[model samples]
Target chain A: MKKLLVLSAFAAMLASGTALADTSGKKIAFSNNYAGNSWRQAMLDSYGIVTKKAVEDKIVAAADVFTTADKEVPTQAAQVQNLILQGYDAIVINAASPDALNGAIKQACDAGIVVVSFDGIVTEPCAYRVVVDFKDMGKQEVEQMAKFQPKGGNLLEIRGLAGTSIDDAIHAGILEGVAAHPEFKIVGSVTGDWDQTTAQKAVATILPSLPDVVGIVDQGGDGYGAAQAFAAANKPRPTIIMGNRQDELKWWKEQKEKDGYKTWSASIAPGVSTLAFWVAQQVLDGRKDIPHDLLVPYLAFTQDDFEAALPKIKEGGVATHEYTQEEAIAAIKANIK
Target chain B: MTAIAPGTLPKSSPRGNAARARLLRGLLPALSLALVLIAIAWLNPRAISYFGFNLMLNLAIPIALATIAQMFVIAGNELDLSIGTFVGFVGCVTATWLRDAPLLGIAVLLGSIGAYALLGALIHLRNLPSIVVTLGMSFVWQGLAILILPKPGGKAPDWLLAIMSFKPPYVPFPIMAALIIAAVVHFGLMRTSYGVILRGSGGNAAALRRAGWSLLKTKIVLFALTGLFGVLSGMALIGITTSADANIGNGYTLLSIAGVILGGGEFVGGRVSPIGAVIGALTLALAASPLLTFMHIPPDWQVAANGAILIIVLAARVLISRRER
Candidate 1:
């Protein structure tokens, strides 16, 4: 027993020595919810480049990445567990669901692994919530539409996964925007799971019923599908459709060549994977001063803005680390509430 | 159960053999869809408009196709869990690689179908139970889909998009194609020698082996047809969605099985119809529309309702079959 205790004591001492390694060099692991979509894939690719560049330039000592292409909660949670087991000082997460991921976040925080959530917000204090100002996002879409429809008109709000924080936040934002415009009558709303098919079909079905409906406040991917639905019906398209998907901007431009591209505009978006990285950095460096929440910058886009952003985004990749650690911290502090 | 050649029951008696086929062919499917529709109407009739009707039919296409694909394999006494992931993978790849080139888009689809068919056949030839292989293959296909697209964004042309959102006055193109496939598959299974041999193989593989026919060959053909349906469905959805997303075919896995049984087909094997699958698929779509309209039900509840409907329909079919026995 004494021999075993001595062995265990030696192991603990070694672990302590490694943890306090003076290089201020610690491994930061970026865990994701699958790089399955073009936007997600692009985001991950950008994360790779930015994390690598930052590490190479001595911004951080070492970096690691883990992904769950299945995008399931358990798989992503396992990735976090594995990162924790590997003794990463801090972990960044693009949680599939805030509630479902709470246990993992708690485990990491309890174990002294700082947890920062981006894109998807976890309600618990353990998370430093970094998200887009989705309410502003919703209000922006309406305001953009207000430019076209000076008189409030009938609207359809195509939503994402129901009951999810991301969808709810965005939906709440859209409603707040709608509150300002009493003239805008909400014709109908449906959950597309943020899928293109459901969005397209929902809009198409609703279109024949509501011919007077002038616009739709879409949740990202659904915007493109809604646009197609409008085109299919051979009706004069809506004056305003808000698309928050950046990767799709390129496709919108290509489509605009034949059809007038002015049919839709994007509010703003935070890169999920990029947010995960920044959150990891923040947690690892022990900057608890950051407020409970932060908003990733958003860029509302027009056809011309898409034309400009497409090359920069596609070439540089989404989440291309425009802000350095100091700049990112400042930005977070500036927006934190 | 019907594998025996009865003394008085006669060989391949339509009552003993064709009864299951007939139920799935016309009667059971039509009844289930009608009952579900009636229930939905009672729950909420406002969702029964022409637009809602179109939405239901459109929603059913992909699920129906996957169900029919599953039916082909299950009917042959095998299983293919990979078909869902296959559709997702092929759908994304076809949409991504040939988003602009319509001809190549179609060609890529055909090639994927061909590849899956060949792969299925190879798996069967290696003496592997398809369920195990297909389970692993589903993961592989899903992973590939992610690797290929990573994010759910891409541009499929507007012309293709038009077909999905616009259903004609006389007949919807999707429904028409579905009808044609149904008729072709139905007649091919009932009238052709190929059909008899394949159905017979499912009933008594050892007996068919004694008769000097290759069950392997027939099963391979079934796999091929299943792959073909997935390809067609993927292409159709590409038009509807106008963008290829990696998770486009999610929930299609279990939903396909639910559709098959609700369409009055059995899990054991033998007898499935493309028409029955369409009815089955549409039944599922309409099942939830009313809840969306009036019941203020969530999709999770609707999914539960679908499962319940499927169970009741399948149980009733089993009872009727037993009573006939």
Candidate 2:
């Protein structure tokens, strides 16, 4: 019995000696709800790039990704259950709904699997959330607009998907920003659903009735569409806030070159999926100090630097940064307090 | 117009051939479901167990309910495009009003069913296209859903959550629920006499009218049943998800229609099977994601693969049905 105790003590000492927890044998699964957009496509790509390296280096055993074909809550809930059944050590998810998948997520947590959610993060208390401060992003949109448009005239608001938590957060932030800066009056608002075509169509439909608009504050992915709507209507272009998409940056650059048009671009990097993966890996490694909710900074670009970053973005993809394990650890440390 | 009653066999075909065709038609949906189940079991043997079924079929109850709702509309020779949005509206109510103010929620739901009856009456009295009317009503339901639950955060009632999570001994809740849904809807729409009249309205409205039956009443009854099932579907979905989103059931429009079609229902004719529809919903809910995941198909191809699976199963159904013709 003493010999067995000594052996166990030695094993414990060996584990502490390594500094980093041994997750080399652990298997991770990524359950992504939707991949229909460029942003989601880039997220998957970033995840694939990072996890493939992690696997080859033996940082983890297997990292498989499962994406639902449709954006249904039940579909994603079912997918999460399947991942639990698959015996994955950890699951990283981009949830379909904030509250809908709690039932499945609770079951996964009960089974002792580490679940990390990002972007469309879950509201389940057991799951770890890696989310961008979308509300802050919305406030910053107006703050940045104040820089370019000193005489804030009538502003139009283009919103994201109506029922999403992110949309509500951003919309609330924008309202707060507008309240702080009384110079800007939101004369018109329309739901863009965060798609360029949908935003363009929505804006075109509502622009005819509105008076002169000097600025447009929007959640990301709809800025370029707003610009196109103004152009198509032959109305004077407004200082539109851009989401960090290649086309939005390119359009901003063209407008800059033509007439010194300046606007701010910001979005949650699609590569946050990689950060989510690393968070799951860290939790599976038995890190105790990590918080359930981790707030990560959003990626933003100003007029001076957006042109330089424009070439780095793929033709139809959003600007994203893939995080390494070290960076993910640092982020976790930053969020600890 | 020559009207062929639902129960009495047509004079055109022999009794044996008709029986064979009827049997084949009845068996086609089950065949499709079995094929999917077998494929799933083959791909991942672990997915066949009780836990596997519990997890896999978790969403099938709501889908089966939604498919039954669509079936009700189709039984009246009318299409309901608004059912998906109506479900979303009902989900919002379930998550909010039903959880908070139970009586008000029940009243609202019953009133919504009355609204559906009114829509049916309007369509009948005005001789309007069901397609156009329901399509327009889809927007109305969506708007109402958004107004009720502007954001996707709501708590499911504890009782509902408990009922949904109930685990029966030796059988998963979802499978048990699917069986109950199938048996109940089949008995209501297939075995009963009034149900035959409802099916006949779709087969030959003119004949039913000539026979002294009120076509308006049948249409209203069918639509009201659609509303009832849609509410059940919405509540079931919320009971599973534990919350509500305004766009939650938006995909059900196509899914429910596909479920009915896959279950051997025709667009123009009053041909529908409640048991077959529940099976078809199960097949679709399985084929929609689980089969693709088990196959290890990459994310890029999963969407296309999903469409391909639908095509293959539906094509098989079509070929079998053609033999019946």
Candidate 3:
């Protein structure tokens, strides 16, 4: 009779624990579009790093990640639908296309799930966005170029993937920046495809025809490649605006030591995914003040700053800054309606 | 050689002129290659130099190798829609296992080729469409590539990089590599006695089978050859890029098919040429980017312009080919 009474009490406790799991924490899923590039790899890695802590701290009940190879919109849409059906409390997406996943996102929204999109974002109204202002990046880069070349000269623009929204916005901002400095002449533009080898090849091909270029404005990921092209031709190194890739930083450090070269580097940190994770946690914690669209600033570093941070980055890894959980919560609170 | 009698000399007729037109039709790919070269030279005279060619054609070695691989399948009247992903899989192997552990890499790559042979046999035995089978295999290969290297971070083996970077005097490495690929494949496929049987299998499989040649063996051999060249192409690509990505060769499937067709190959016919295929690859590579970039066209329109060039060249070939009839 005593054993039976003990068993009944244990079963009641188990039932209560099960009932409390829902209110204790929320289940989250990360949907990634492509895992082919280093930047994406780093972003995904950051998610793993942050979610482990979040899970241990009871900020999230469970976290899962999925990636598609071809960046097909249909595949990602299906993935989001599966996440919703799996009863996830929130879904974080680096979307393949801006508008293709809206219907699925809306269905999730109707289910009362929180959705946050970052980097390559979705266009769904229900989804909150965490993005860096790429136009400002372009404008800032050109302004830096102007400072480097006080006596305005020809500028070669090494652009990112053609026809991408980010590419268009950055180019527009660059044009705006150039308009402010009439002395800077836009000589030519070429798509680097956001790859080092491709950028190198394109720059090498175009190098023969151009006049003396005083400065170069390029999207992040191709700065080292452009430098290599100039080196190959044995031409005087132009003042290249640096991208915050580790390889670029290493090269810049070497140049600074060897020739006292000076340059600035700036980019959207790969750790922005961590910020997205923290924001999701805050929103799930009943922080109703979070803004719909959160604009994160780009991480900018001078040559000395890069040298100081160089040791922190691993070989073959990208250069990025940390976004602490406290800072993410603070920012959201400040921006809340 | 039997000598024609002086009194029985044939008169010059329209048939002779028709024969000449057919001969010219066969030379259309070569002519088009020359035309493209001339156009490139006209746009940028310095591009015709040795250093310029080296830089311009640095990436052509892989394309040429891929075209040859596609040619092997086309010679058997079978297309490989999986060659691109197959190359990516091979590239992943080369950049990771092949660089880190040489023996295991060789075994895996050889095993992959064997798998290709089996795939060819299976398609033949089941009477499956090559297109459907290869398309299915494309996904499998891509999945395997991702499994091997989840991200784009593997380094190409040092020896392969060394070979790719070798700079010979006067002749560019790419041009030399192209010539060597063409000549070797031509000799292997066109000059050997067994090669005739291979071509015969495509032209008339029933006749070949009647003569005791195994259709299954020919199919397997053709696919294995394709696997061999695809591996070479992948390795060469990594050697140049010095890294690997799972989707690096995604564009190669259509490019290989286009190369084969543009090189005077037919969809169902046994007609194909190694030299022409390489030239076609070179032409397509030139037209794809360098030509348009040199023309000062915007990047957004370059892809469309490339299609236009291909259409115009193919149309010119068709116009000349019509005269053969």
Candidate 4:
């Protein structure tokens, strides 16, 4: 009876070995913070493309997906737990909140699941910290302001949400760059929190009091509202400004065409889809056994550079609307850090 | 609604009688303000000084504007979870566009009232319930904000920040602003035909409509005023924080609602009192201020506290109404 049982076990192993023996037979799990937003949805779509090819080509055993509805911290935290319970080798996480997600992240690592964060990073030395260096973006914006201002001008800096590590770190980087330039005096700043109407109201009231404002450093969409506010006041536009969205590029172009010139320069950061590919790959690789942290590099762009960056953006998967998964992932991995 | 009946000035009452009632009504809000002042003084002895008093006034100005903005919406049975978004967007827009143009920044801030009023009117005319619409609008605007300033770093107009942040002793700008808005609001909705119509529409739109009134117009105007006033509050807040960041007005939404409920404003809508709204806003500001200084509760509890206060205040109002009934 014992001999027969041993023989039967070997037979079962051989049967399963046909599929699992492939060098790329490792399975991966991708967990995202939110599917409701365009950025997150773009990432999830990229993951599907990348994972599908990997599985069909016999490179990956399987790929699972986990995503939340909003920037809900605990909900994303629980997603990590579900991935862990399923014995997933790795997970690409887009944490909704920093610091708040540490415990769950630590839990995923304890269970030997490789974790890689993209876009918004977890401050902890998790398996990998993948992000577009916000601080670097800040530095680039200040440096551009320096160029725009042969004689230092007043820079009214607008920030993202406060308290989040993203906002905190980016400001740190911007100040470091801006402080060195004595000519670029910071007039004042307030948290705009990324709303068009709210920012419009704020600009309307403040524009009356702060004349000679030359530069504006802020998020992309709200910049449109700020520009609108300035137009409403019948004031000439500011000379130096920084923004970071591709869609808003259209708005800038429209402004230029309609009004002869524009002041928007974007220090483009790779979106969340880049995160999806790497995180998916890390899981497929054997890196699942030990936790590792990684950071994705961000690129700065000028008026001349933006047109060049657009092609790369166009090549990136469902987000770009033009590239196949294999082609886009290969290009992104090859071109960027 | 019954609260209005008892407060009606008596036709037969002599001058002193009216004065005494006015004094009592006025004193309640004043007392609430004094208690908060006393608490601040007791907590930090140095906080009572000339500069300290000025500081409190400076602090009060932003919150007071916010409270009044919140009061109008609540009085008409609406909610604005968007003021937080409003403050953030308004502050950033002002900082980014008018950091150098002091005069223009002020104009932009005032002009936004029309902008907000129009936007507020659109929200009503679109034929949807306000709470959900405003909440969705907040998210959309917040997303728009990220798109605008994706990362943090912007400057506010100096004069704008100074105007919001600085206050001399014996003169409270936020109080003055709120009272002025309140008086205008009070008169607009009371002494004038328009005010009476607004009140009547708020209390019973069906009856108002049956009487050949445009309840729809009244609702839209009330909300527009509510938004305008709320944006007015955002103007002060834009100055106080003094930087443009996406999350600047994050917590103001719930805080605004709480101010209305705390000052004895009702939740079912249509009951507004300038004096009560002022007291409520002060009460909320005072409660929130104390928590920041003296407590070690969870950071998220601030939001919970606002919601809890609303419930408690509503319950108290219910019980009081029951006793009176």
DockQ of 3: 0.02
lDDT of 4 by residue, A42-153 (tens): 5555556656776787666777655443354433554555455455677776666544455456667886766777666665565576555677767767777777666877
lDDT of 2 by residue, B1-325 (tens): 3556888856655757867887888898998888889988898899898889988897888889999999988988889999999999999999999989999999999999999999999999999999999999999999999899987888788999999989899988899999999999899888999999999999988888999999999999999999999999999999988888888899899899999989989877688989889999999999987787888887788778889998988888888778776
DockQ of each: 0.02, 0.61, 0.02, 0.02
lDDT of 4 by residue, B136-239 (tens): 87886677556655644455567766676555467556556557656765676658877777766667667778999875677667666765666556556546
Q: State how far residue A275 of model 2 sits from its true place (Å).
A: 0.5
- Give the CA lDDT, 0 to 100, for residue A288 in model 1: 56
Model 3 misplacement above 4 A: A1-337, B1-14
Recovery fraction of native interface contacts for candidate 4: 0.00
**Runs in model 2 lying further than 4 Å from the true structure:** A1-21, A145-157, A175-193, A196-216, A226-240, A254-263, B1-19
Model 3: CAPRI class: incorrect
For candidate 2, the per-residue lDDT at B61 reads: 85
**Clash numbers, per candidate:** 10, 0, 1, 85
True lDDT of residue A251, candidate 1: 54
Better candidate number, 1 or 2, judged by TM-score: 2
**What proportion of the true contacts does each candidate reproduce?**
0.00, 0.66, 0.00, 0.00
TM, every model: 0.49, 0.89, 0.52, 0.45
Q: With candidate 2 superimposed using the best TM-score fit, by how many Å does residue B51's alpha carbon deviate from the native?
A: 1.7
**Relative to the unseen true structure, what is the C-alpha lDDT of residue B222 in candidate 3, on a scale of 0 to 100?**
90
Give the higher-DockQ candidate: 2 or 3: 2
User: DockQ (C-alpha) of model 1?
Assistant: 0.02
Better of 1 and 3 by lDDT: 3
- Model 3: clashing residue pairs? A289-A336
